[model samples]
Each structure stands twice: as structure tokens, then as C-alpha cells.
Target: MTPAPAGLTCRLCGRADLRSVLDLGAAPPCQRFMTADQLDEPEPGLPLHLRLCADCLLLQIPPLLSPADNFTDYAYYSSFSSSWVAHARRFVERAARELLPADAFVVEVAANDGYLLQHVAARGIRCLGIEPSENCSDAARRRGVPVHTAFLDKATAERVRAEHGPADLVIANNVWAHVPDVVGFTRALATLVAEHGRISIEVHHALSLVRDAQFDTIYHEHFQYWTVLAAERALAVAGLRLVDVELLPTHGGSIRLWAVPAASDVPVSGAVARVRQLERTAGLDTPAGYQGLAPAVGQIRDGLLRLLLDARAAGQRVVGYGAAGKGQTLLNYAGVRPDLLAWIADKNPYKHGRYAPGTRIPVVDVDRIEQERPDLILVLPWNLREEITGQLSGVGRWGGRLVFAQPRLTVIDPGAAAIEGAA
Candidate 1:
């Protein structure tokens, strides 16, 4: 792959001096994980630099890596995890009760494998999904969920409006923050949704990411880290206004925002006002918030690298758990290679036969842990550390320990399960 650019202008506000909060050194491009036969030649490493808009307090990395580079046929599948399936089902059920009626149309963006939209369809409501990943779109189609394999923008919005009329409910989860054109993307939603339509967007809360030190979520694909304040500004610029909001435990503390056209009757709830107040208290939407993250992020990097180096020096075999996107970000930023981690294990079959995004570490079955019997196991998807620790309970039969790096690096014996509020 070719390099994208030296840096990018702010997608939300078009400003530069995008202060660098943390720099994860170059590693193999994440999501370029290939088969053994394709491994003779390697892909190029893009700069994994994290920046903040001092003016907007938006956390983002330059699109040093473009959307097309990362979103190929085999991007991601949502049906693999039963836990996530339940999460989607609950979301649809709640949406049906609180937001949508039986006769209205509901559209989902990046509706991989129709995992969430299936619930909406089952409620006898009209539904459509716009997914860019061909593999995931095919899977969704197989499940009888109509999916369009195309990137959504203003033009597509007009086309959809001409064909199916404006949507009554638009649901985009975790997709809004990945686009470089925040204004245009939200404008598309504004165009595609009717005046009476309701739009709900879910994205990682940038404020929580900084306060909790979830630095791993910073990557090439995630274009912007959105806070309620930042999103409100972008949406308002696109002719929409936020009405209601909720903080979800999903994806390491995400914000679910309900919005409508600026002229609509959707009442702006206290939740929106409360979230703005929270942003002010956290110093978000300003340059000071961006400046404050630098020092704390440095400490996290130093701590994790020191632990890995010390374990290597002591002749301990180390392995990684979870081939998660966030894990890839942390590995590339820390400059960790296959030399430090023997291999990685994951439950997602889509990645089981592939290597990691940047490290080129092969992903094997969960038994690799028991077979290799590594002295130390680093859990990359530390958010799921509890579930993983529960499943891998036998790791301690040979005295193995599991370590997680998040707010800080902590090592827990398998017998210990997990620390409170981890991940």
C-alpha cells in the first residue's frame, strides 16, 4: 500500500496543528493480514499517529490510511459473537418501543451481516441496510436482509430518497466516527432522513477514551474521535440537531445520540444539555483538553513497553490474546512484532487463518494457549478480559498468568479472573 499523506486537515472543522497526542511507531498496516502463501511479500506500514483538534477537542488520526485500504471484502462480521448478537437485539427492541413505529422505515449503516437490522425487520417494520463490505453484505443478503454494497454519501442519499423515499428511522452505529468527511456524511443522513424521521448514531465517546486511557482505539480506520459536543457541532452544521442521548457500555463506553432535522418537532432533551456540561467539565471542545492527554498517554506507553521488555529479558514466553482492532493499534504504536508475541488467539473465524493487522502474528485456535503454554499472555481486547479469563480457566493448571494493558498494565493470575471495571 502507498502512504496517504503527511497529515490531514481536521475533518470536523478543517483546521490543522492537530497536536500529536501520542505516536504509535510504524508497523505493518493493520487489517492487511494475509495467508502464508501471500506472506512472501509484505504490505507497507502507514503512520499510526494520534492527534487532537485543539480547537474542537476531537481525537483523530490522519487518514494516513484510507477507507478503501482497510475496508476490503473480508472486513468484519457481526454475527460471530453471540454476546454482540444479543446486544444488537436489545438495541432494536428498545428502538422499536422508544423511537420507531410499526409502519415506519428503518435504515442501518454498515449493517454487517444484518445482525441488528434483522431485529428491526422482525418487528414488521420496513428496513434497509447500507454496508460497504461485500463479504458482509453477502452474508446479510443470505439472511434475507436487503443490503446495498456502497459507501453512503449525499449522492447515495438522494438516490435512496428517489427510490424508497426518506427513511423514518436511520441507525448508524460505530460508522460515523470512521469517515473523514464528517460534514458531508452527516449531511447525507440529513438528506436521507425525512423531517419527521429519527436518527440515532452510536460512536466511541472521545471524552471517555481520554479519561480511561483507551489509546488503543486510535487507528488508521477510525478517522475521528467524537464527543457529544463535537458531534453536535458537526450535525448542526449538516442541518440536524441532537435531541436525546445515552451512554452505552458497548465498544468501551460509547455514546448513542438521537437526532432530527433542525426544523423538526423532536424535543431536545436534558440529556443533550447534560452531555455538553460534561464536556465542559472535562475540558473537551477546547485546546486545553488536547494538551492534557499527552503526558498521561506517555505514561501508558512507557508502562506497557517496560513490562513487555522485562518479561522478554526474564526468558518468559509471551503470547497475545484477541486479534482485535484496538489490539493492533496498541501493538503498532508500541512497535511490538512477532518476536515479542509467539502468536495470537481469537474466537472470530474470519481472522483465525489470518495474521494480525500490523504485527504479522498468526492467529490460531484458542488451544494454542494450552499447547504453547506461554508463561505470560497479554490480553489485547482487555474489554473482554473477563469473558476470556472465564473461558481460558485452564491456563493456570501450568501456572500461566494473564496480563492486560488499558488504563495501566496489570497482570492477574488466571485464578484472579479480573480486576474491577477493567476494559
Candidate 2:
């Protein structure tokens, strides 16, 4: 109930009425995967707390770190997840068929490794990517997707607009929540779109975070957790109106927002009102809606720790499946160390030899799962359980079971039905 400290204002509304929702203590930057040489050195931790703005209803955290610190040399590549790439392909195809003109100029912000823009280019459409990470942008260029390696801000938006004219369609997927300046980022998004063009944004819905106790998704890299209400307010700051919203199953749960210039007179889709009502019904329009998350987060932490301890006592070998950001947050917050989880397996070769940021668990290739055949495979990125479960389905041959910690610990047999209390 104490007032937010001076200068701690809402990133979207500039309001000082920021109320604490949940605090996961302090955690190291989730993406700061350390090499074996650097593991001996001290790794710094920052405050990982979630707050809600009473004025704008924006669910956010203090900007403890800058985008440059987190994204300059990013570790995540969108191409690693086959399902995610397929989702991007479908989105691009739908946009081209239903929204874009014959000669539309498409621009995507934070286009990691040209996952989506490659699909645009395959359709013979002129597309460009704005990526901050030099390595990621290099990969994009290799895919024949044009890229501008810079963060999107007002000045950068103006320069891009001046160079290429306003984009016929601008896509900012999964990057909206990572930005600290919500209003400014929305303005940049507006500046990039043509007068009558559409801007598409995809953000993990905060409703799912609270309802499902997805506290693992709260890391320093992600500055905010968005809702349709907060998104509409941010969009209005840039003279853009939310014309449509589509709920997606990706990233646990997400909302794809479609916005257009306010003066464009585009008819608002009924989905907008429907999603708005859902948020309202869930009490996301007010500060009180976030009150239940702190306790839910505690349950997740205790449940995961207990599960790990039980497995270890039973002489079970447990290893993590993904070296994802969410996994880093969950493991670090729950105080899980290498003793509980031997090593994590990831498909991204960039992380194969590195160690998880805070937990310091060695990251190995997916082949390690077959080599070690651990008794339990703790799937960290629970949102991608289906995809990961399919990939690790062969684990059933070795009597290895899969474990999902969030939303409660559920142990499942990869080739059989989920055994709720099997763990």
C-alpha cells in the first residue's frame, strides 16, 4: 500500500500509482548464459517484481536493465522451435492473403533470425527486419531477409520511415513485452505503419500469467505483461486504435492485437470488444485483479522444489529439457541447483556448451537425453509442453517420465495418458 518511489511511474501512462503484485525476490538476467570460464565469477542479480498501474492497468516491472544489456547479443532463435516457425509462416500467409496489397512493403520489429520475414520474402513480397542483435540480424540476412540492426525508437522509426516510406504492414511479435518504454514503443510502431496500413503486435496475455500462475515468465528481459486494456491505452497514445484482437495458444496464451491509425476509419472488429469484455470480466481492468498471484507463485515454487527433492531422494536422475528464459526464472527463483537437475538440453547450438544463467546447470545438446536417459525430464518451458513432449516421446521407451512444474506439478508418460500423481 505504500506509494511507489519517486520516478517509478507507469511506463504506459506515466502514473505513480504502481502497486506491487508479486515479487520473486532478485534474479540474475535470465538470458545471461555463462561460459564455463565465467561461471567462477560473480553473476549479478536484479529485482524481479511485478506491479500493476492503477491508472492504466498495465502489468509491468521496474526497468532494472536496459534493452541493450539484454538484447545486444541475444541467445534465443525463433527457428529452433519448429512449431513457432510454422506459426509465423501461417501468420505471414494469412496477412498476405487477407491484408496486404500486391506490392506491400512489410516491416517486422525484433525479427529474430528472419523467422517470420523469411516467409514474407518467400511470397516475393518486399520485407525488411529491424533487429537489435548483430548476430541475430546476420542470421536474418543469410536467410535473404533484409534487416536493419537497431532497436526501434522514435528516431529509428523516423529514419526507417524516411528511407523506405511508411510500411504497408508492421509486425511486432513477442517483442512488445520486452520493451521498457511502452508508450514510446507503441509510438514507434505507429510511426512505422502507413497512414492506412495495419500494425500487428503479439504479446503474452497477462490474464494467463495470473490465472495460471506463470510467474516463470516474469524476468528482467520482459519488462511488461500486457492485457487488452493496457494495450489499448498504449496504442491510443500513438494515435492508433485497437481494431481487432485474436487469442492464441502460443507462449501459454497470447493476444494478437491489430491496430490502425485513428483517422483511418477502419471498422473495429467485434473480437476487440469480445476480448475487452473478457479482460473486464476477469477484473484485469482494475488493480485488485492481480492480488492472487503472489500466493500462486509461492505454490509453484514449493511444488517444484518438493518434486525435485522427492525425485533426488528416490535416486532418480532428473534433467531439464529447454534452456529457455522461463526455465531460468523458474529454476533461479525456486533455488534449484545442479544437484536437483544435472543439466539442461536445448536444440540451439549457441547454448549447447553454455551454462544456465543463475542455476549454473550445464546446457547440453538434445542428444544427451538419449545418452543419459534420465529417470525424469523436467520440461521447463511448460508452454511448449506439447511440442517438447512430442520431441521427447521416445523417452517412454526407457521408462522416463516428463514433468511440468508450473500450474502444479503433473507427471506424464510420453507414450501414455498423463498420470497426475505419478511423480
Candidate 3:
């Protein structure tokens, strides 16, 4: 409708055949943090919305802000979670054994807090990190991982190669979907990659997300949701070919893939063939599959709102848990205010006292959820719903219920008993 808004364009093919699927209006940048004093001033925001391309299985949103501004001062610290640090360590340890060519250098783009690079450096592997966030770069440097504090563009890629020399292994995790200049960025990847060097990228899979109705993941920071097929098409244009692929349990369901120059004759792994089959079965390359997305996402949003209204009419107090980025997008899209969610709780100290983006739903510690004992506790981060419900089993004795905002709002009975909408 309305030409899908100029902001909507295919991130991979740059095709204009974009259709609006979900629109979360006027949300502040997901990772943009501010000092307490700066909060009083007007903070700018844009429509946190998304679209899907029928030609390619790429789901994307319009580019509102440049990664240069948002990423260079990025306040997100990857090592804040102990588990994330351990995950990074395991990745680097495996990468060293598999991808790292003897003494060749390794580089990680968006190497936040040096989580992965620390592991690389500890292994005595020559490594460097290209981190746009100044704060994160400083922390990475402190951890003995030399970091370049600038966004990785073609120019920056050349500079990095000249400065640290070309890397034998290039790792970009959870960032391949966030960039608007997908072409330039991938080309830069090709340029920075050493002769026959391998590049590994991990991104949230579009096919799985749509199939599961994970609409909450839509936000401004995530410019695209990529599938293996879409990535293959994009990479082919950049003179690169995927050598292997693996689906990881991380981030609900994500694709971790390895690729190298197209000239290499290495046989494509079985995993790649399996994904191709999966894509065909899902009809991702067809228009009918694209047509199903908007309706399914709408049904989820409508179902959740109806449940919340019913709970409110029944004189139940409802609060939300997890002020995550997805929570921000979901809350904003749902038009949920403090009236619907008394407050939201998060484990991260940095966000605990702040408000959810756009909705301004106050954030508090998990103890607040226990203390309030509301009849309904909305699990905003549906990806972590099972883990949270298991940990907070004690709060339901007060007739408190656990509700998930995704796949429709269904409540778990106060005693943590299985009830309608248990996923």
C-alpha cells in the first residue's frame, strides 16, 4: 500500500518490490543510550517498521539512522551477560581450530567489549577487532584486543587491512542483518578477507522467524531478516560463496554460516543442501509465502491485545517482564502504556531503572515482580519465556499468571499450571 513507503526496499537486491508487514511507529534507536541529563532533552526517533520482498526472502525496514552515528557511540556491552562471554569464548576457541590459518590474523567486526577477541588473543592468535562503539572499543583495548573505533565500511575495511594486515578469519556475528548498505558491507567483507580466507556470519533467520510469528524482533536497528537463500543471492553478487552453514540454538533460532571467495572449489557442505531443501519446502521464494506473513503477524498482535483487554476487564493487574529491544518494539507496536503494564522488569542493571523505548514503560528489577505479585505478568521477551517462568515459579502463589506477548496472549495459571496458550 502507498508504494510500501520509500523507506521500504529490499536490503539485498535493492529491489523496490517491498510490502509492509509490520509497522512499529516512532521508536527511539534500540541501542542508543543517553546520560541521565540528556534524557530531559528531545531524543529523536523514527518509525520502527518492517517489510518483506516477494522476489527474495528478505524482510527489512527502512534505514532511518546511519550505523556510523548509532554504532560508533554504541552503548551496548556484549559481555554484560556472563553467558554471552562464555558463548564468545567457545566460538573463538572453535574458530581458531577450524578457520584460523596457522599464524594468519583474525578480525571481528562489531567486536563488542572484546568478548570474542579476548578469547582469540588468549590463544596467541594474531587478532584485531573493528568496533564502532568508542566506549566498547576502549573496553576491548583494555582487554588487550586492539580495536579500530569506526564503523566498517569499504574505506574502513581498506584501512583495517592496511593497518592490521588482511585477516585469515573474519567473524561478524549478529550484525549481518543490521546494516542498510548490505552491498557495500559485503563487498568490504570480500575486500578485507585474505586470499581463500573464511568469513563467518550469524544472523536471525527470516524463514524461521516468520514461520514462528516472532514479530517482536522487528525494530529500527535490525534492517533485515536474512535467510540462507537470500544471503546466497547477495553473496553471489559480491563474488563470494557460502562454503557451509549451521543452524544454532542461539537467539531463538539463528543461522551461523561460513563463506569464502567464489573461486574456491571446496565442496559445499551438506548443511547448505539441507537449508536449500528447507527453503523450498517453506516456499520462501514464492509470492504465496510472502502473502501469508502480514496476516499472521496481525493475528498475533490482535490476539494479544484482546487477551490484555480481557484481563483488564476482569480487574487483573498486569505487569511486563524483560525490557529487551524486542520488548520495546512489541510494546510500542501494541500501543501498550503504563496502564496496561504497571512496569517492566529486566535483569540488566543499565536498563532496570530506565523506560522501555517509546512506550516509556518503567523498568525495574525482578524483585519488583515478586513484590507486586500482579495477577498477570507479561513476558515481553517471548524468546526467554520458558527460562523466566521456571525461575519465577514462586510468584504465582498469589494467583499471579504468566503471559507471553508473542503468538497471541495466553496466560499460564497462577500456580504455574499449564493453561491456554502454553507454548
Candidate 4:
């Protein structure tokens, strides 16, 4: 057998003892939105093979793109989802009460557009955002959230600690998965954290990803899909203890973990044990646990393709709702192109007038949906189906329907209408 790709070591455990679990073939970088002038040239793609580490039981992908290549001028803005913004506010409200006091120092990693840190700063908390994306960091600074535009590794963490002292609270929400050197990132978290400080890391639960068949979330940007057991092993190596864990509904299904210095006297909460046991019971720590997603991924891809082809054959026009990163993965993997998907409508002005990376589908403002009034609107971010459905509910007035293609393709109807799918 041919050897696995070089540098295929586990991001968390530093183990080269890896097994190939699934392959979605080659795909372009998820956030590389293209302009019209660049479309005619050949687009590049990288191998997107998922590997499982037997030592740590972590499911991860080798980093194909560097941090500068992916995040310097990022197109994704966190505030696009109203529900996500609300989730951030609620997290701030709880963190302020439970984690830190007013006037205490707080630092958020990958804090984009100040969505969460704005709430932290609003409460008289001295907060700084460590973000690498200049476009997003500038927006956060404009929102009065002080931001340091650099990736958070050991050196940057030491620099921040020197400037601001040890942080009482460090937020690594949803960014751990993006870090190529997750061990380095966790060590940085340990470096910035005060002796008694708390670090909260939010990650989409890998168990949930397998259970719900959310394979579309498997993109190049997300280097790892975390399970609680895997996270515990990683954090322990950094001299941090997983003290608490909370399951969240945001981003399909996620978990918020609270860690503290290993020497700290805080008793590990029961929530940690509960989630760890739940993961073990689900067989996440073994190779058998990682075996289910390949078949489901194929079914979802085929289902979505059939739906689009049938719609086109029936003379029904189809346009996508959001040009999200996950949507790009789904489209590119399922072999969707501009011929099948007319255009994608997005709220972000930066993404508007751009093209999706591999498919080259035109991304326009939502007004295109209003002007063209396609017969079917394929909502790309299926996790936000309810919110997107309500926002586009007015489409019913024109006999148009909204459809989602995760966990299977299903047409949504608000008025007790029957859910439709491919035959």
C-alpha cells in the first residue's frame, strides 16, 4: 500500500500512527471566494482525506493551506447569523457572571467582528481580541473591541501576556478546529491564562457530526473534528484540566469546554464525566466509531444532486441561499456547477459579486432571489434552516420553496406542507 501523505501526524497527539477513515476527494479552500476576473483560469484543489489517530482517537485532516493563505483577509463575518450573535451575547452574559468579574481581563481568540467580545467589552471588562484576519480584526476594532491582528501561538501569547498581564479569561470559540498546530494553540492558551484563570474552548462535537451525518462540515479549514475524549487528552498534555463541558445547539451541535490549570484545586464537574462517558459509549475512541460517515456522506451527495437535476429537468429554477464554507464543500464534492446551481444569494456585501471557489457559482445579494424568484431556493447552511426558512418565508407568496440538503435533502414548508425530497 502507498504511504499516507507526509505530515499526516495527528494535530493534537503528534502521532504518525494514523489510519485513513474517509476521503471526500480533492476540494478547494473553503473560504477562497473568487472574483469574476479569476474564474476563467484553472482552479486548484487539494486532497481532503480524513485520518484517525489510534493513540488519541482524534479525527483530523492534514493542513493543506497555511494560516496566512486562509485567514489574512477572510470573507466570513461572525455576525451574519442573528442566532449566532445572540448565542455569543448569551455566552458573554454567563461568562461575565461565572468566569470573570468586571474590570478583569478577557481575551478572545479568532474573535471576528467583535461579535462576542463586544458584549464582554460592553460590561466594563478589559477585553482584547486576537484575530489573524485583517479585514475582520479591523471591523472588530471599529466596533470598539481592541484586537491584535496575529495568529495565537506561543510567541504571540507571550507578547499579549507581556502587554496586558495574564488574562483572567481566554476564549477560544470555534477556532481550535482551524489551528494547524492545535497543541501549540492549546499551549498558548495555557501561557496567556492566569494561574487561576479559565479557558473556554468551543468545538463542534465529533460524535454529533457522525450521529447526524453532518459530513459537509468537513472542510479543509477545519483541521480537526473533536471528541471530548480527544480534547481531554490534548488539554492534559498542555497542563490544563477539563473542568466542565456544556453541549450547545449552535453550529449544528457543539460543546463548550472549560479548562483550568492542572494544579488548580477546582473539582472536575460531573458534566465532564457525563460527556466523556457518552462519547465512549458511542464508541468514539475506537476505529469502529469512525466507520459510519462515508456511506451517509455518499447518500447525501447523491440525494442533493438528484434533487437539483430533477428540478432542472422539470423546468424549475434553483438558486442557493448562502455561499457558506460548508456549502462550498457540499457543492464541490457533489459535483455541482453553475449549470446546475444558477446563483447563490448571500447577505455579506464582501461575498456578493464574488464567485464560489470551485463551482464558480455567482454570489449575489438577496435581491437576486427577489428579482428572479426561482422556483426552489437551496439553503446551503442547513444548520440555520429554521432561521433561513423564516427569513425567506415570503417566498411562499410566489409559490417558491426552501430546501436543505444535510442529513438528506428535504423541502421545508412552514404551513404544515408535506416535506418533499428526491424519489
Which prediction has the highest TM-score against the true structure?
Answer: 2
RMSD (Å) of each candidate, 1 decimal? 3.5, 1.2, 3.0, 1.6
- Per-residue C-alpha lDDT of model 3 across residues 150-181, encoded as one tens digit per residue: 77899999998888787798999988877889
Model 3 clashing residue pairs (backbone): none
User: In model 3, which runs have C-alpha deviations exceeding 4 angstroms?
Assistant: 1-11, 24-26, 32-45, 54-57, 370-375, 386-401, 407-423
Question: Candidate 4, residues 131-202: lDDT per residue as tens digits?
Answer: 999999999998899999999999999999999999999999899899888888899999999998999999
lDDT of 1 by residue, 31-123 (tens): 667787777776777776777766666677776665666665755677766667898899888878877766888888878889998887777
Q: Residues 1-423, candidate 2: write the lDDT tens digits.
A: 345667798888888999889888888999899998998899998988788888888888999899999999999999999999999999998999899999899999999999999999989999899999999999999999999999999999999999999999999999999998878888999999999899999989998998898898899989999999888888998999999999999999999999999999899999988988888888788787778888888887887888899989999999999999999999998999999999999999999899998889999999999998999999988998889889999999989999998667899999885667732
How many clashing residue pairs appear in each of the predictions shown?
3, 0, 0, 0
Report residue 372 deviation for candidate 1 (angstroms).
3.2
Point out the higher-scoring one by lDDT: 2 or 3.
Answer: 2
Q: By summed lDDT, which 10 consecutive residues of candidate 1 come out lowest?
A: 1-10
RMSD from true fold, candidate 3: 3.0
Candidate ranking (TM-score, best to worst): 2, 4, 1, 3
Better of 3 and 4 by TM-score: 4
Clashing pairs in 1: 24-333, 30-357, 31-357
For each candidate in turn, the TM-score is 0.91, 0.98, 0.88, 0.97
**Candidate 3: count of backbone clashes, pairs at least 3 residues apart or interchain:** 0
